[model samples]
Target: MTTTRPVLYLFGSAAPPVFDVAAVVADAQGRGFEVCLGLTSTAARWLEPRKAGLERLTGHPVRSAYKMPGEPDVWPKADVIAVAPATFNTVNAWALGITREFVVGVVAEGIGKGIPMVAMPCVNAAYAQHRQFERSIADLRGMGVRVLYGDGGFVPNLPGRGKPEEYPWHLLLGAVEEIRGAQGEGRSS
Candidate 1:
């Protein structure tokens, strides 16, 4: 509400889809979001080659770490977040509110800030079956973080074999819109 365009925090994990972030950024912008990118440490390297291009697309530094205590924040406050290809590790850590990494820190804090958020997990079926993964999904859903997983959302691939065609990157932007619209209309997200 403070700005004409929503400030979107587009967070990427270490999934193979992280390499295709340029398309995601373009899509979010097309949907009227002013995107900012944040990568999990593992994802930071995967995107290093595209960092400058990403910065140019987003008009903000692609941050992968916490700034020094005295350093000023560079990114604008987020209106919503879309974490496509969220990994199993980040999902569970975020559910536990662990701030071990920069992406986790921002997302954990986003939950507290009551910002609308949507996440699309990119885990294999074996990883998705873990008891903790189920619990984490429930916990996040309870806190109103939309987890785009299972059934109509993301379907798990075979262990050690994720096909790029099946990552479901296109679903995330729509999920964000649905959740944000629901929230905007005072409906449950």
Candidate 2:
């Protein structure tokens, strides 16, 4: 059966904050989104113990790999996509169009499909200092992604001193709501 609720494809990478995805999913649901959880391969393994519970929460199977050709899609089509706690590798790979990971592949393709997408990176201060990180952020912005980084979004913490608990998941959820609203306006106009 199809759902009337706006569907959100919430993707997470292998970062410390990813462990808190259950709460994030609940929060997204509270905000009226029908969320589908997707993870990078490593993040899937990291949360393997909680996989079944996550499925129960979202009412959909958690996906980490592309389905075999001809396999039917289990989740509803996404109205918006949000990548929270995106890792250093995920950011670079997405900006470079590398689709080895399912999460990156969807977001990369989402650009061409005109799906509103947002991403917030979770990286240590040292990794943030890498020149490529800044360029990737810029590239993603150029491609129309609302990357929640720096100032108002995720600010990297010092290596070995990171606080995953402080990651601003609310910002991503708020952005999704805002994007959905804008899409509605555009459709009416």
Candidate 3:
């Protein structure tokens, strides 16, 4: 099917990404994409739903997995799935095809249907450097997922780590662009 308006599924982990998510949402809206966001239970603590007024902004309701009752079977037929600030837990789950959570279930279904998945991981140096985490990324890639390279080896907002030139909007959207490109090439999930 020819999709005029690309559907984007935005997922944030319990620990929000270092970059701002509100800006990401605005950018996606400006780009003419339909946005639906899923916030991990843990992520909501760091992220304020009121800050973005996410439901109003995305034109779709926003809720955490626990708060949301039943599976969201009729998602917007996403052209791309962007999981930025993907926590170690979320990334691992996606890599393993585990659908225990809301975001995991959406991504699992998306990948199974040939949608491209983009994961932008944010974690402490220790976790990022762990062998298990590394293997999980490998497994995701093996499953045709794209793991975008972020500020590796540097902790966000920490002194001496320096800051990335592009803020949350760019980094997350850039990953989406990569997924869009892969999709145009008929890449599988």
Candidate 4:
């Protein structure tokens, strides 16, 4: 469906940085995106107290569960998706096509729809050391999702030493803009 502004599906997992989602949503909206917020069930519970405020901020419902079958979609069709503060479990579940969670399910289906997508993992150094973590990152990248981890993206912190205030939320927003710009170029060419 056509929208006045690009629709961005912003999904979050149960990471410490997920608590900072209010600012992230505002940042996305400021970047010319109609933001729709989705979260892992755990993250939803973590932010329960702020759910109403988030709905007001995004002008849409905060979703953490699949809509009932045949229910009308409440949000605009996504032009792009950004999954930030992706936890180790979320990254693996998505890469393995395990869509038990609402956020993972949308992003998994988004891949087949050819929607531009980006992900930034919030794993610690210990989780990053796991073999599955590296494989999952590669798998998501192979499926055309731009993963913001290592180098210029999110760097894993030592366990128990994470600075949630320092999560690279801006980088995720920047990638969304870059993806939108690239899509615009492709359409014009």
**Whole-model lDDT per candidate:** 0.88, 0.95, 0.70, 0.96
- Can you give the TM-score per candidate against the true fold? 0.93, 0.98, 0.77, 0.98
Output the worst ten-in-a-row residue range by lDDT, candidate 1: 180-189
Which tens-of-lDDT digit does each residue in 1-189 have in candidate 1?
A: 246787889999998988889888999899888989999998998889889999999889999999999998787788789887899999999999989889989888988889989998999989988999999999999998989888778888889888866678778988887766775787543
Model 4 lDDT tens row, 115-180: 999999999999999999999999999999999999989999999999999999989999999999
Worst 10 residues of 4 by lDDT: 1-10
For each candidate, C-alpha RMSD in Å?
Answer: 2.5, 0.8, 4.4, 0.9
The residue pairs found clashing in candidate 2 are none
Per-residue lDDT value at 106 in model 2 = 95
Q: Which ten residues in a row have the lowest lDDT in candidate 3?
A: 153-162
lDDT ranking from best candidate downward: 4, 2, 1, 3
Q: How many residue pairs clash (N, CA or C atoms closer than 3 angstroms) in each of the candidate models, in the order given? A: 0, 0, 2, 0
Which regions of candidate 2 fall more than 4 Å away from where they truly are?
none
TM-score of 2: 0.98
